[model samples]
Structures are given as structure tokens and as C-alpha cells.
Target: MFLAWNEIKRNKLKFSLIIGVLVMISYLLFLLSGLASGLMNMNREGIDKWQADAIVLNKDANQTVEQSLFNKEDVSNSLKKQTTLKQSGVIISNGTHEENALLFGVTDKSFLVPKMIEGKKFHKDNEVIADESLKDKGFKLGDKLSLSQSDEKLKIVGFSESAKYNASPVLFSNNNTIQKLNPSLSSDKTNAVVVKDANWQKKSLPNNLEAIKIENFIKNLPGYQAQNLTLNFMIIFLLVISATVIGIFLYVITLQKTNLFGVLKAQGFTNGYLAKVVLSQTFIIALIGTLIGLILTIITSAFLPSVVPIKFSIVTLTIYGVVLIAVSLIGSLFSILTIRKVDPLKAIG
Candidate 1:
């Protein structure tokens, strides 16, 4: 470790340049990871807020909540206790302020509803609770929003954090209001039912209904599965590229110090000691780079435009940083092998 520190102190510029490169790459990786997590939350936060174990949908709907239809009778007859039925649909706002929004028709006291961050839950017909993201679109508590398809105006009664569905801000309304908005939908029918207990797989389901785990249900959301897979592949690809870059950098650095390594061997330094120096140097570099990257990521996330959804979790960042250091250490193994191969006589000649 002393040897590694002395070497780094002697060649500060070279090591600093490598550290800068690592910082940039790690920052990019963390940024992408944050975006991926934010997108996932946007896609499923509404469902996640439900905190339900299983979701029941019409099997004929092919695992899509919007296409599924079940009524109170179906829930009472087929679903176990602690179930909440919710109707969901995509509706456009009226006029020039037009935007697609996910409308969730939920019972006032249902566990499926998100806790209000501001104001109170819906208590009257046409009253609604919306995601905080809607605030960016000029929506506020007590504001009246008109649906494009229906003349009925909804009064925003509350706002909640992180209540989004399929990349659209979610609004919770009374089942009666949703039925009024969409006359085609039966008064008793809901898009899906959230089940809390009982093994859905073990229990017999109704003829047309299927129970899917919450994770699987989230995957079935439009573009969710594909988007996650693509982003995850990109993250993996970037990690591999980062490892290669580190490996090549360390290998080149080791090559430049070949004579020094040979002289150290001639002075009775063990191969294990030299290997330790190289790994210690790698660890120091990785730690510094990762810290810089993390700080930059946090700053960037703080200043990012609301238009760009980016979620940062400390746990996720820590995991990524650890993995990065591990990869960098693996990359340094090449230097260790080069150290082992250094011939003591080569330095004397």
C-alpha cells in the first residue's frame, strides 16, 4: 500500500487522468440507472402503491389490466378477503390542455389508494385525487378538470406523491364517476381486483379470471418489459466496457513500470507484495472515481428538469459503486500477472 501510494504521489497527473475517465464513465452509468429506475416507477407506481400481493384480471384479456373486466359479483364470488376492485382507463383532458392521463376508479376506503400528500381523499362524486406530477401541468387542489370524452368535470380534491401509471399521472375517482365518464363500461365492472392474501395459484379461480403476481403484472404493462430489458442490457454493456477500459489502462501502466517491478523483485520483494501494491492502487483509484461520480450524479439529479424523470436510491448507487470497484480490482489482476512475470535480471541489464 505504501508503494502504491508513493507511486501515485510521484505520478499524480497520469493517475488523475485515469481517475477522471473513470469518473465520467461511472457518472454516465449512474445517470442511466437513475433514469431506468424512474421510468419503471412511472410505469408502475400506482400499482406499487396498492401494496397488494396479487392482481386478478380476465384471462381472456391476455394479462392486460385495461382489457380485463370484472364486476362486484365476480370479486365477491371468486376473490378472497382483503380484495379491492379498481377500474382503470386512459382518458384525455379537454381542449388545448389535452394530455393523456390514467384514471383509476377506486373505493374511497380501499387499501389500493395512495396516501394523500396534500388535501384529503375523495369524499364526493366527481372528486378526484391526482399524482403530484400533475401539478406541473397547472393542476392544483380544488381545480376542475374536464375529460375529453365526457362532459363531466372532475374536481381535484387531493394530490399524492409517485402515483403514476404507464408514464402518465394517475387520478383516483369514485367508481360512480368513472362509470359516468365511460357509459360503455358496466356500473359493476372494474378493470381488475387487487388481492391481499391466500395463495392465488392454489385457490380455484373463476372461469375467466387469472391471478398474477404483482411483479409479473408490472411486467405486462405496455413497453415496460421491453424497455427494462433494453436498458438493463445497455447497463450491462457499459459495465463490461468500463472493465475493459480499466484493464487496458492498468496493463499499460504496468508495462511502463516493468523495469521498476524487476528491480523490486531483485531487492527481494515477493510477487504477492507487488500484486498487493497493484490491487491497492486500483482500489484507491476506483474509490476516488466512484465517489466523484456519485457526487456528480447526486448534483445532476438535483438540478435535472422536471421533464426528465430521474430517481436516485442510495442503496442502488452503493451497489453499483461496489460492483464498479470489484470490476476495477478484477481489471488490476492483469497487472498482478505482469508483476509475477518480471525477471529480476532484466532491471540489472
Candidate 2:
């Protein structure tokens, strides 16, 4: 350990350069991970909050919620089988504030409606709840918001933190109001029903009806699977890049001190002691780089928009940090092998 520290101190320029490379790699990876998570959040934040067990869609639509249809009789029939049903629909419209918006029509029983961050849930006829982020676009409670797509006017009664399916602020409304706005929909039937059962059998479902768990259903959406796959690949690629950069840096540093390590071995130093030194140096450098990378990620994330959709928990960040440390330890093993090839006699001359 002492020898490793002395060597690093003597080669300050080389060590600093190696450490700088590690810092840059770690920083870039952290940024990519945050962006990937943010993109996914923006794409699915609205649907993710619904604590639903399963969603029913039209079998012919092949997993698209928008294409699924439910008449009142079909919906009522499905509700009788021990599952609560909520009518919901998504319609693109121009908001009163003149922004392109997506209206989320959901009944009072809809699970998504109860997550009110401000104001109240959907009530009163023709009244709707908007996402709080839309307030900056000139929306206010009691103000009339128009759905130009259907030429319907709705009263904004409340606002919440829920964003749209694709970053647009969502407007919550009841089934009747949604049907009235878009008369093509039968008021009796619902778009989908959230089911709560582990033993759900899709085979038993009647023809043209499909039951899917939320996770499976989410992937079936047109761009959902492709988008998630792209982000996941980006995160994995960055992680690999970070590991490779750290490994190369350590390997180069170890190669430069081959003769010095050979002399140390002749002077009664055990390989184990030498290993301790190498590991200590690697760990110290890696810890510093990882810490700096995480700090930079947090600082940058602060300036992003609320609707940009980045969801991360303490557990996720902790796991990422652990993975970084583990990869660095694995990378140090390459240098340990170099120590075995040191010829003590060669250095004595």
C-alpha cells in the first residue's frame, strides 16, 4: 500500500491524467443514465401512476388502448365479474391557452383521478381537472378550457401533477362528458378496465377482448417498447464504456511501473501486500470519480423541466454506485496479473 501511494505521488501527472479520464467516463455515463430515465418518465408518467393490476383492450387492436372499444353493455358485463371498471379515453386538443394538449377522460372511479397534487378530483358535470404544470400556459380553476378537436368546452375545476401520456398535460373528465364531447363513443361502454388478480387468464376472455397486466400492456403501446429499448441500450452502453475506460487507465499505469514493482518484490514485499496497494489506489480513484459524477448528474437534473419525466429512487442510485465500484474492482484484477510477470533479477541490474 505504501509503495503504491509513493509511486502514484511520484507520477502525479500520469496519475492525474488517468483519474481525469475516469472522471469524464463516469460523468458521461451518469448523464446518459439520467437522460434515459427521463425520457421513459416523460413517455409514461401518466400511465405509471395508476395502481392497476390489469388493463383490458381490444384484441383486434393488438394492445393499443386507443383502439379498444367498450359499449356500456360490454363494460357492465365485465364489471359484474368482481372487477371495478373505470372509463377512460385520450383525445388530442388545443387548450384554452392555445397549447397542443391531450385530454384524459376518466370517470370518477378511475384510479388515475385520485392522485390530486392540488385542487380537487373530477366532479360537477362538464368539469375537468388539469395537471398543475399547465398553469403556466394560462389555465386556472373555474376557467373554461376548450377541446377544439371535439368542439366541446369544459370547466377546469382542479389541477394535479400528472403529465400526459407523451409529455402533454392531462385533463381529467368523466365518461359522460367525454362521450358528449366525442359523440361517436357510446356512453355505456368504457375504453378499458383495471383488473386486480394474479390468476387472470387471457384465454378465457371472450373473442375481441384481451386482458393484459400493466407492464405487458405498457410495452404493447406503439412506441413504448421501442423507446424503452433504446433508452436501456444507451444506459448499458455507457456503463460498458465507463468500465472500459477505467480498465485501460489502470492497465497503462500498472505497465509503466513494471520495473519498480519487480524491485519491490525482491525487497521482501509479498504479492499480497503489493495487491493491497494496487487495490487501495484503484478504490480511491474510483470513489472520487463516482462521487463527482453523481454530483454533476444531480446538479444538471435540477434545471430540467418537470414534464421531462425522470423517475429515480434512492435504491436505483445506490445500485448504480455499487455496480460502478464492483466493475472498478474487477478492472484492477488485470493489473494484479501484471505483478506476477515481474522479474526481480531484471530490475536488480
Candidate 3:
């Protein structure tokens, strides 16, 4: 181990170059991971906050919250237990204060409505809870904002953070509010229904209504699964690339030190001890690189708003750390093979 440390210290430039490559790869992996997770959050953050146990949609809707529609009466009749009305649609931008947004029309009983970051929830006529990011877009509490592609206006009553789906800020209002804007909408129905009961099963649901756990229901949302899969693939690809690069770098380092390892073997050092030395070095370098990259990610994320949709949970960090270390350890294994190949007789020459 002392010999390995001295070798590394003596070849500072070479060791530094190897560590530098690892750092760059680590940084790229971390950045890509953040972007992928961010994109997913932008698409599903609102639903995640709903706290609903189940979501009900029309069986024929084929994984689209937008396509599912159930009248207030249909939902009422379908409800064998606790349930709430939920309406959702994209907001298209026209001219004026009317901008593009995603609308979520819910009844007073809906759990999807976010708790206020400022004022109150929907109560009186024209009342709406809006995303805080929309305030700069010419919306304010007590001011009227029109939904684009429609002539009707809803009054903003409060503000919330993030509150988005499919990368658009979400606005919450009552079904009556949406009815006034979209006359073509069913006079009595909602986009979907969410339930908190645990006993819900698909076969037990009323005909034409499909019951799904909230997580499963989100997967059933149009484009949700595809988008998530694509982003996840990108993240996985980046991690793989990082591992390959680090492994190649370590392998080259090990190859260059083969003769030195032969000399060490001649001096009575066992292959096992030499392997530990190389493995320890690889781990130390990887740990430093990962820590630095993660710190940078957090700093960059701090400047971004909730609307940006990037979130790093403890679980994500733990998994990332585990994967990175595992990759580094794999890279270190190359040196072990090189250590085994050392011929003490060749060094005696």
C-alpha cells in the first residue's frame, strides 16, 4: 500500500489526469440525471402532490386524462365510496393576459387542489388557484385571466408553487368555471374522478369506469409512460458512459504500472495486498469526484425555480452514490488482473 501511494505521489501529473477524466464523466452523469428527473417532475409533480389513493377514468379513454370524461351524475352513481371530481385540459395562449396553461377543474371535494402558498382556496364565483410562475405573465389575485382559445375568464384567488403537468403550470378552478368557458363540455361531467379508498378494484367499479391506483393511473396518462421511459433511458446511458470512461482510464493506469508491480512482487508484496492498494486508490478518487459533482448539481439547482421541475430526493442520491461506487469498483478490478500477471522473475533481471 505504501509503495502504491508513493507511486501515485511520484506520478502526480498522470494520477491527476486520470482523476480529472473521472471528474468530468461524473459531472456529466450527475447533470444528465438531474435533467431526466426534472423532466419527469415537470410532467407529474401535480399528480404526485394529490395524495389520492386511486384515479378513475373511462375505460375507452386509453391512458389519457384529457380524453376521460364522467358527468357529475355518472361519478356520483359510480361512487360506492369516497370520490371527488377532477377536470384537466391544456391552456392555449392567445393574445392579452390570456396565456397558455393547463387547467384542472375540480369540485370543492377534490384532493387535487393545492393548499395555498398565499391566500385561500376556491370559494366564491370566478375564484381560481393559480401557479405562482403565472403572476409575471399578467395574472394576479383578484384579477381576471382568460383561458386562451375560449372567451370566458376566471378570477385568480390564490397562488401555489409548481402545480404543473406535462411541463405546463396548472390552474385550479371549479367545474362550473370551466363549463362557462368550454360550452362544448358535458353540462354535468368532469374529466376524471379520484378516490382515496383502499378497497377499489377494477372489476368492482361500475361499467365503463376503470379504477387504478394513483401511481398506476399516472402511468396511464397519455404520453406519461413514454416520456418517462425516454428520459430514464438517457440517464442510464449517461451513467454507462461514465462507467466505461472511468474503467478505461483506470485500466490504462494499471497497465503502465505493470513493471513496477513486478518489482513490488519481487520485494515480497503479495498480489492481494497490491490489489487492495489499487482498489483503495480508485475508490478515493471516485469519492472525491462524485462529491464535487453532486455539490455542483445542488448549487445549480438552487437557482432554478420550482417551475423548472427538477427535484433531488434522498432516495435518488442514495441510488446514484451506490451505482457510481459500484462502477468505480468494477473499474478497479482491472488493476487486480494486472497485479496477478506480475512476474517477480522478470523484475529480478
Candidate 4:
């Protein structure tokens, strides 16, 4: 470690360049990771709020809530405890601005009802709870929103944060409101049934219903699986490419120090001690660079536009940082092998 510190200090420019490369790679990775998480949140954050173990959709709906609809009889009989939900996309306007909203028709006692960040829950047929994003578009508690292209009106009674479906803000209301908005829907039908526990088996469900694990349900959501796959592949590719680049850079620099290492060995330093210096230097550089990169990411997140989708998870970032450092150490092993092969007398003579 002492030799490692001395070498870094004596060759500040070279080590600094290595650290700079690491920071850039780490920054890019963190940014991509954050975006992937955020996009997923945009697609399915509303479902996550339910915290349900699984959902039952019509086997014929092809795992899509939009295409699934069934009467409440079987779900009520098959599961002792469950919540039924009816969802549809509707255009809403605050009289001045129009936007698409995924309207959910949930009973007051249903677990699908999220706690409000402001105001009270919807208890009346026409009262509603909307995602907080609506506030940016001139919405306020008690404001009346009209179902665009129709005469139906709903009053916003509350706001919930990050409640979205299919990248659109979610609106919560009673079945009556949704029924009033879309009279084509049958009175007793629900698009999905949510179960709080994973107790029920697939064979036990109604002949028309299929049980879908929460993860599978989310992944099956239209466009979500593809988006997640693409971003994940990019993130993986970035890590591999960055690791290789770092390894090659370190390998070249180590080769440059062949004479110095040979001199140290001639003075009676053991290969084990020399190997420790190489690893210690790698760890230090990776740690410092990763930390700086994380800081930059945090700062960059603060300045990002609201339109940008990103979520920074402390746990995720910490894991990535550890992986980067570990890989750096592993890469240094090649350099360690080089140190081991250095001929003391041949080089120093």
C-alpha cells in the first residue's frame, strides 16, 4: 500500500487520467441505470402501489388488463380476499388543458386505493383522486374535470404521487364515475382481480381466469418488457466495455513500470508484496473515481428536466460501485502476474 501510494503520488498525471476514465464510465452507467428504473416506474408504478401478490386476468385477454373483463362472481368465490379493478384510458380536461389519464374504478375499501398526499379519499360517485402531476396543469383539489368529448364531469378530491399507468397519470374514482363516463361497460364486470397473498393455485381459479405473478404481469404490460430489455442490455454492455478498457489501460501502464518493479525486486521485495501494491493502487483509484462519478450523477440528477425519467436507488448505486471496484481489482491481477515474472538481476543490470 505504501509503495502504491508513493507510485501514484510520483505519477499523478498518469493515475489521474485513469481515474478520469473511470469517472466517465461510471457516470454513464449510473445515468442509464437511473433512466431504466424511472421508465419502469412510469410504466407500472401504479401497480406497485397495490403491493398485491398477483392478479387474475381472463386467459383470453392475453395478459392485458385492457382486454380482460369478467364478472365478480368467480373471483369472489375462488379467493377469500381480493380486490376487483376496472381500468380504462380517458381524456380529461381542466376546461383549459386536455390530457390522457388512465382512469381506475375502485371501491372505497379496495387495497388499490392509495393514501392521498393531499385532501381526502373519493367516497362519492363523481369525486376523484388524481396523480399529483395534474397540479402542474392547473389542477387543484375541488376542481371539476370533464371527460373530454363527453358531458360527464368529475371533481378532484385528492392527489397521489407517482401513481401512473402506461406512462400516463392515473385517476382514481368510484365504479359509478367510470360507468357514467363509459356506459358501454357492463355493471358487474371488472378488468382484473388482485390477490394480497400467493395462496391460490392456478387450477383453483375460474376456468376463464389465469393467475399471473406480479413480475410477469408487469413485464407483460405493453412496451414495458421491450423497454426494460433494451436498457438492461445497454447497461450490461457498458459495464463489460468499461471493464475491458480499464483493464487494458492498467495493463499498458504496468508494462511501462517494468524497470521500476524489477529494481524494487532486486532490492529484495517479494512478489507477494509487489502484487499487493498493484491491487492496492487499483482499489484506491477505483474507489476515488467511483465516488466522484456518483457525486456527479447526484448533481446531474438535480439539474435534469422534469421530462427526463430517472430514479436513483441508493442500493442499486452502491451495488454498481462495488462491482466496479471489484472488477478493477480483478483486472489488476494481470499486472500482478507481470510483476511476478519480472527478472530482478536481468532488468536492474
Candidate 5:
């Protein structure tokens, strides 16, 4: 490690270039990860708040919540022995601003109710709880918003963060309010039922509804599976590319220093010591690069417009950082092998 540090200090420019490349790749990876998480949140943030284990939808709807419908009897019978919350969602335009939003009808005490960031929960028929993102749409506390298809208007009584469904901000209202807006749905009918028990799958379910795990339910959201798979592929590709880049760089650098390594071996240095130096150098470079990339990601996310969909999670970043270091170490293995194969006598001559 001491020799490794001395070598990097002596060849600052050469190592700096390698670190720069790593920083660029890591930055892109983190950014893409943030975008993927943000988009996912936009699509399912409201549902995520429920933290339910399973979602019950009509089997005939073919796994789509919007197409699934349930009658009051079905929901009542299903909830008799299990803890469940029923919710109905619809996408409609805000009558006053002409902006599209997702409206959800939820009971006040239901587990599906979002944590309020400000104001109070819905208590009256016309009162609604909205996503804080609606502030961008010019909605404020006590503002009246009419439903596009119905004469009923809702007053924004509370705001919650990250409350969205299917790329639209979510509004929480009473089931009665939703029935008023869409007369086609009866007051007892809801689009889906959220089951609270993790073992919900083992429990007997109503014949008319099927229990889908929460994770599976999220994947079934339109475009969610495809989008996530693409982003994940890109991230994996970048990781592999980064490893290749590091391996090639270190291998070439080791080749250039073959004579030096031979001389050191002749001077009684062990192969293990030389290999350690190479790995130490790789570790240092990876650490610096990951830190710089993380800092840059933080700065970039900070300056981004509020409307931009980018979410930074510490756990995700940490996992990426760990992978980067591990891959870098693996990349240096080729150089280590080269050091072990060095012929001391011939190279020194």
C-alpha cells in the first residue's frame, strides 16, 4: 500500500486520467438510477404508501386495476375475516386548470390513506387531500377544484408528498365523492382492495377477486416493467464497461512497468507484495472516483428543476458504490496476474 501510494503520487497525471473516466461513468450510473427510481415513484407513489402485502383485483380485468370492478357485496364479503382497505381511482382533468390528475376515493381511517405533510385529512364530502406536487399546478390549501366530468367540486384540505398514481398527482376523497363523479361506479364498489397481512396469499380469498402481491401489482402498472428493465440493463452495461475500462488501463500500466516490477522482484520483493500494491492502487482510484461522482450527483440533483423526476436514495447509491469498488478490484486482478508472472532475471538484464 505504501509503494502503491508513492507510485500514484509520482504519476499523478496518469492516474488522474483513469480516475476521471471512472468518475464520468459512475456519475452517469447514479443519475440513471435516480431517474429510474423517480419514474417508478411517479407511477406508484400513492400505492406504495399503502404498504399492503397484496392487492385484490377482479380476475376478469386481466390484472389491470382500472378495468377491474367490484360490487359492494364482493368487497364486504372479502373483508369479513381479513383487514382490508378499498380504493377507487380515476384519471380526470382539473376543471379549473385543465390539468390532468388521478383521483382516489379512500376512507379516512384506511391504511391506504397517505401521511399528510400539511393541513388535515378529508372529513367532508367535497374535501380532498392532494399531492404536494399539485402546488406546481397552482393548487393551494382551501382551493376549489372541480372534476372535469362531474358538477362536484373538491376543496384541497391537505397535501402529501410523493402521492401519485400512473404519472398523475393523486387526490384522496371519500368513496361517496368518487361515486358522485363517476355514476357508473356504485358507492360500495371500489377498483381494488388492499390486504394488510403478508400471508394474504395463503388466506382464502373471495372467488370473484384474486390476490396479487404488492410487488407484482406494481410491475403490472403500464410501462413500469419495460421501463425498469431497460434502465436496469443500461446500468448493468455501464458497470461492465467500467470494469473493462479499468482492467485495460491497469493491464497496460502494468505492462509499461514490467521492468520496474522485475527489478523490484530481483531486490527480494514478493509477488504477493506487488499484487497487493496493484489492488491497493485500484481501491484508491475507485474510492476517489465514487466519492466525486456521488458529490456531483448530489449537486446536480440539487440544481434540477422541481418538476424534474429524479430521486436520490442513500441505500441505492451505497449499493452502487459498493459494486463499483468490487468491480474495480476485480479489474485489477489481471494486472496482479501479470505481476506474478514477471521473470525477475530476464527483465533486469
Candidate 6:
């Protein structure tokens, strides 16, 4: 390690280039991870707000809440106490301006409604509380927003934070309001029944309905699985490339220092001693590169606009940082093996 430290200090610019490559790879990995996490949250923000124990969906709907339909009376009969929801995708218009929104129908006492950031929560059907993003689109409290393809108009009674679903702003109202907006969903048919029973996940019920864990339900949300799959693949690919590049960089440096290693070997430097030189250099480079990368990611997120889906989770970032450094060290094994093959006399000749 002493020899390794001396060489790195003497050739700072060359080592800097090695660190630069890792910095870029690690930056991309962390940035993508943050974006992936952020986008997943955006997809199920409202669902998470519920802190729901389980969701009971129609068996024929294949676990998708949006597709599942149940009659309130039927669900009411099966579960002693439950909150019913009717979700529909629709457009809201203020005549000149329109925005895509999810219309959510919940009973008067349903706990699915998020705490308000401003104004008051809806206490009746057709009166609604919306995600604050709608305010940016020129909506204000007490404004009437019309439902597309229907005569129904929803009054924006309040604004809530982080109440989006599938990346769309939600209009939280009662079951009758949503039923008015979507013809397919009649007044009697709600999309799903939500219950907080402790053993609901394993509960057997009638009416072709079954309860599922909320985590599983969120994972199955439309577009959630596929989008995460693509981003995760990119993260994994960058990790592999990072390891390979770090290994190659260290290996090339080892080649240029072959004669130096040979001279040290002639002076009775053990193979074990030479190996530590490479290992120590590898650890230092990995640590510095990942730190710089994580910092850059945080700085980049700070400058990004609100609309960009990027959220930094220190825990997730730390996990990735550890992984990057571990793999980089594993990669250094290649250069360590190269050091073992160094010959004293033949190389110094």
C-alpha cells in the first residue's frame, strides 16, 4: 500500500482519468435508481397514503384495481366493515382548459382521502379535493371542473399533497360522483372493496372476490411493473459496465508498472505485499469515485425542475454505493492476479 500510495501521488492525472470513468458510471446508476424509485411512488402515491391493510378485488379483473368492479351491496354483505372505492380515468375541463385526472369515489367516512394541504376535504359526492398540481393548471378552490363525456361537474373544494395515482392528479369524491362521469361504472358498481382486517390477506370471501396485500396490489398497478423492469435493467447494466471498466483501468496501470513491480520483487518484495498495493489502490479509487458520484447525483436532483421524476433516498443510494465499491474491489482481483505473474529478472532485463 505504501508503494501504491507513492505511485498514485506521482501520477495523479493518470489515476484521475480512472476515477473519472467510475464517477460517470456510478452517477448514472444512482440517478437512474432515484428516478426509478420516484416514478414508482408517483404511480401509487394515493394508495400508499391509505396505509391500507388489504384490497379485495373481483377475481375476474385479474388483480387490477381499475378493472375490478363490485356491487357495494355484494361487498357489504361479505365484509362486516369496509370502504368501497370506484376509480375512473377522466378529463376535467374548465371550458377552455382540460387536464387528465383520476376520479376516485369513496364513501363519506372513507379514510382514503388524504389530509388537506389547503381548504377543506369533500364531505359529499361531486365535491372534490384534488392533488395540488392541478392548481398549476389554473384550477382554484371552489372552481367547477366538468367531467369529460358527462354532464357532471366537480367542484374543487380543497387541495391535497402527493395524492396522485398512475402519474395523474386525483379528484377525490364519493361513489355517486364517479359513477356519473363513467358510464361503464354504474352507480351500483364500485371498483374495489378495501378492508383493514388483520387477517384479510388470507381471508376467504364470497362474490368472487379475494383480499391481497397492499404491497402486491401496488406492484400490479398498470404500467408499474414494466416501467420498473426497464429502469432496473439499465441500473444493472451500468453496474456491470462499471465493474468491467474499473478492472480494465487497474489492469492497464499494472501493465505500465510491470518493470517497477519486478524491481521491487528483486528487492525481496513478497507477492502478498504487491497484491496489497493493488487492493489498496482499488479500494481508495472506488471509495472516492462513488462518493463523488453520489454527491453529483444529489446536486443534479437539486437543479432539476419539479416535473422531473427524481427523488433521492439516502438508504437506497447508500446501498447502491456499497454495491458499487464492493464490485469495484472484486474487479481489482484481475489486476492482483496480473501482479502475481510479474517476473523479477526477466522484466528488469
Number of the top TM-score candidate: 6
Candidate 2 Cα RMSD after full superposition onto the native fold (Å): 3.0
Worst 10 residues of 1 by lDDT: 87-96
Instruction: Work out the TM-score per prediction.
Output: 0.93, 0.86, 0.88, 0.92, 0.89, 0.94
For model 5, how does the per-residue alpha-carbon lDDT over 1-349 read when each residue is reduced to its tens digit?
8888999999999999999999999999999999999998888888787777888888998888767788646655544233333344443444456567777777768776677889999888878888888877767888877655677778889998767877878788887777777766676676777777756766666788898888888888889988899999999999999899999999999999999999999999999988889999999999999999999999999899988988999999999999988998998899999999999998888
Pairwise lDDT winner, candidates 2 and 6:
6
lDDT of 4 by residue, 223-333 (tens): 998999999999888777767877887889988988888898888889999888888999989999999999999999999977687999999999889988887787778
Runs off by more than 4 Å, candidate 4: 136-138
Error of 4 at 319 (Å): 1.0
Q: After superposition, which runs of candidate 2 have C-alpha atoms over 4 Å from their true positions?
A: 75-96, 136-138, 202-204
lDDT of 3 at 108: 77
Q: Of the pair 3 and 6, which is ahead by TM-score? A: 6
lDDT of 5 at 83: 32
Specify the poorest-scoring 10-residue window by lDDT in model 6: 72-81
What is the alpha-carbon lDDT of model 6 when measured against the actual structure? 0.85
Candidate 6 local lDDT, 1-349, one digit each (tens) = 7777787898999889988988998999999999999899889888898877888889999997788887767757555457988888888887767899888888777888887899987877789988887887778888888775788778988998868888888888876777777766787787888877776645567758778888898888879999999999999888888889989999998899899899999999899988888888988888899999989998999899877878789999999999999899888899889989989988899
Residue 266 CA displacement from its true place in model 2, Å: 1.1
Across residues 1-349, which tens digit of lDDT does each residue of candidate 1 receive? 8878899999999999889988998998899899899899889888888778898888899887777777656767655555545555556463335567878877768887777789999988898888888877767788878776777888888998867888888888888888787664566677777887656667677787888998898888889988888888988887888788888999999999889888888989999988999999999999999999999999898889887977889999999999988988998888889888889897657
Between candidates 3 and 4, the one scoring higher on TM-score is: 4
Ten residues in a row with the worst lDDT in model 3? 86-95
lDDT of candidate 1 at residue 311, scale 0 to 100: 88
Q: Is candidate 2 or candidate 5 better by TM-score?
A: 5
Clash count in backbone of candidate 4: 0
Segments of candidate 3 deviating more than 4 angstroms: 75-81, 84-98, 136-138, 184-187, 305-307
